[model samples]
Target: MPLALYLLALAVFAMGTSEFMLAGLVPDIASDLDVSVGTAGALTSAYAIGMIVGAPLVAAFARNWPTRTSLLSFILAFAAAHAVGALTPDFPVLFATRVVAALANAGFLAVTLTTAATLVSPDRKGRALAVLLSGTTTATVAGVPGGAVFGTLFGWRATFWTVAALCLPAALGVLKGISAGLVQEHAADGPASHTELATDGPALRTELAQLARPRLILVMLLGALVNAATFAGFTFLAPVVTDAAGLGELWVPVALVLFGVGAFTGVTVAGRLSDRHPGPVIAVAGPLLLIGWPALALLAAEPVALLTLVFVQGALSFALGSTLITRVLYEAAGAPTMAGSYATTALNMGAAVGPLLAATTLGTAAGTLGPLWSSGLLIAAALLIALPLRTTISTGRGIEVPR
Candidate 1:
């Protein structure tokens, strides 16, 4: 709605392009760098590892700074890293640059959510945060596909260069449009004292204190596990469509576009549903995943069913994604920024663990059915983890979701 939010969306679009373009460019990167495809695949894994490691690292260290300063610095670093990625000759150096860009991207998203959450009144918090996240979702539709086409038309280097160039303008737009008022709202809630943070931070002593409440830990772990399940299938959906569904290669991008369309629609609707009834919305997402997986699995022979399931799964996953983030923020009300950071860390952890499991299963099994089964089982496990969360929430918020 606001110009600033739109600018933040632009920033997110560029960041999304930079982060996800690797999947499309992997074969080229491997060819250019003289590495195996498996080795090139590690670039995606490395980015996940970087985000997981960077989220809290940046939050813990940068918690005291103004949001604008923190966000701008991270954006600049993100742009610079991509530029270097466009030029790096050594594989290791290029890999490191990608990681640096990932760290910057991770840091930016966490801060962006915090910033966005504080932009509006408590009642609109979910909606505001959803709008910011939409940028990332949009990138799946627009940026990554565009990058893939650019990579094909020119080269992988050209794709990186394009992203880097886009980032510069995005950075300028963010600076011009970002409000001091929004920045101040975020800064207003400073980190808790050292004693509180000690009980909260991820130290040997803090783990016991934080985990003493079963409900909070339940929320966090379930959130992470569901995310892991979501990505397990998500990481390879395009290939699955073409290879398993017997859809022609040309349909891969179209299916992804549909997937993104479903996701965008799901996220907006989920935010509204969560606003009206958070608990029920949260409970429903996992089962939807369970149901959708069966339809998706039939893709080995039933192409039409697989295509339909892909859209259904994408919608359900993203809708619940907003609910999960809001839940985590609510659970960690004492530490919004830290909670935001931890939520992202959970996503990154999920991103890492899910794909690893999917890859392992797909690698070992006889057919595409392996990953489909594995993903379904994992989603069931994640749902079981979420069962206890209903008992934890108090209804007093009435969808108001206090800041």
Candidate 2:
């Protein structure tokens, strides 16, 4: 709702574009660098690894700095990394640059999410998070496709240059929109303010201990499982549509566009509902995915049915996603920055694992249908884990911890 929050979303858009654009340019990168496509694909893995390892580390290192300062610093570094990536001559250099870029992206995301939560009232945290995350969904719909087109026309390096250029505006937005004094005010008003913990050793330790609670741990696991379930089917969506659903190759892009539209819609709906009823929203999201997947496997042979199911699946997954992030913040209401970093790490882990699981399934007799069924069972397990926790839906002052 605040100008600062939208600025943070803009920053996320730049980062999300850089993160996903590589998926579209892998073939070009492999050929340019004189490596196998598999090796170039490892660049994606390298970036995910950096995100998982870098988020908490950066959050800890920047714990003492003002939120605005950390965010700007990270984005500057992210922009610089892309510049280097565009100029790199060899695969090794490009791979290392990818890691650096990912670290910067992870740091930026952790600080931005915490800052966004602080900018809004407690009841609006879920909606705020959805607004920030919309950047990623938008990237999938627009930026990735744009990058692919740019890479095809110019060169892969040109796409990286464009990503670098995008970050400049985001950096300027953070500089102009967020101020040191505003950061202090928002932190003071927030449910979990890191400003006080940054200087107090004992308070920081207590905050870390709160994050280690069994309830919080369960929520993190659920976050990982939910993402894994979503990605499992998504990683091989093209094959599923073509082979399993008996659709033409031409239909793959159409299906993806439909899914992206559904995702945007889902985030919008979830943001509004989560502000009032996060617990109930989360409870339904997983089960809906559970039901949707099996139905997809059964009905995918029909084009209209397949397209309808894909859209629904996208909507359900993203709706669950926003709530999962909100749930983590509620559980770790005393350490929002650390909680956000942990949530990012958990989600990245799932993103890496899901594709592997799907690939293995595709190798089996079950083929493409394996991902749909597997994802359903995984969501079912996640729902069972999540249903028992008592989440703080809303509080007048901030999210309240259950005693």
Candidate 3:
């Protein structure tokens, strides 16, 4: 692996940490701002909205800029946003800063992916993408947990401040290291580059156009459904454990940590498994979804059953998640960055939908089990969608031909 890959991973790690740490620190922020949890929840949702919007916009508009310049600008922008977030005294100001930070976050990810594709040989692109994505997975394991701990010890504002400090080191690494050539291609034709892929372009176009195909549409549809399934129950985890499982407030952070652990393991395993035997890896994630539903239900009914089932549900359901993105990249050969942005945007849309569904479901149900029940059923539905694709999808290997 190139040293640049490691630097890219560090950048992703810092970004992921900054994004996810908000979940654990929402209460602190809410308390400090004298706002409701629902309002503070918007802070998370706002970031997702920013990511969805910024991904394509930046990719399209900033396509002509140098990679180093683009990345450095994004990092500096992200640092500024976080600095504002750390210092803001009012909720509205903080919300605006979160939106800016999210824009930086999305742009950073899109560029990182496009750069990774250019950094390695064609055949090794999957692995290259995985190396960069590891930062996201690793964040679940370490960054989020560490941020949560920091928030507990210091305050929510302190977490953002810490992230800003971390950003400086990440920025320095990228500034000093990335080659100018690495990012130049992303802007190659800007909008005109479609002609470059002619002959091969149609195949790539068809792959991206698959976003509209029924089966492909099914996959995209499930992206939102799957996340909704997780978030519906997850968003209200605190209330559920407290009310239904008879757990204390302390269990909330503990549960999140467990969720993080499961997700961390899932992403790492999925990356490796997808490379070796993607078919079976994706196949297994389907049944894992079904199993997780019952596990969550059982755990909800008997809180003592927490550790085993919750962890299982968290890990198994998400195992094949990012692998699906890899599959999309496989299909979208020439326009990998746009395809990546599409995949990510779809997931973000799903994330947004999931929370809305939870708000509605949890509002009506007598207890926390309502959202949990809803999330489980949706996950099972996602399983049905994923199972058939595994049998039909065929991704061929390739050697790097002249561009």
Residue pairs clashing, model 2: none
Candidate 1 global CA lDDT score: 0.72
The weakest ten consecutive residues by lDDT in model 1 span 191-200
Against the true structure, what is each candidate's TM-score?
0.88, 0.92, 0.84
- Report the candidate with higher TM-score, 1 versus 2: 2
If both were scored by lDDT, which would come out higher, candidate 1 or candidate 3? Answer: 1
Off by over 4 Å in 1: 179-213, 364-366, 393-403
lDDT of 2 at 394: 26
Q: Largest TM-score belongs to which candidate?
A: 2
lDDT per residue as tens, model 1, 263-303:
78888887676644777776677688887776687655677
Sorting all predicted structures by TM-score, with the top scorer first, yields: 2, 1, 3
TM-score of 2: 0.92
Deviation from native of the Cα of residue 402 in model 1, angstroms: 8.7
Model 3 lDDT per residue over 1-403, tens place: 5667778788788888887788788888999999999899888888988988987677656555667777888888998988888898899999999899888878887777766666655555556766876787677668988898999999988888887777787787777767553432323223211122223223334435656655445555666677667667666777766777788888776776677678767766766666446677666776767666656766675876765666666676566666665555555444544655666666667667776776776667445667767777787777777666655442335223234
* Model 2, residue 72: C-alpha shift (Å): 0.9
RMSD of each: 4.8, 3.2, 5.1
Kindly list the per-residue Cα lDDT of model 2 for residues 248-286, writing each as its tens digit. 877877777677777778888888877668666776777
| Model 3: residue 170 alpha-carbon error in angstroms | 1.9
Query: Cα lDDT of all candidates, in order?
Result: 0.72, 0.78, 0.69
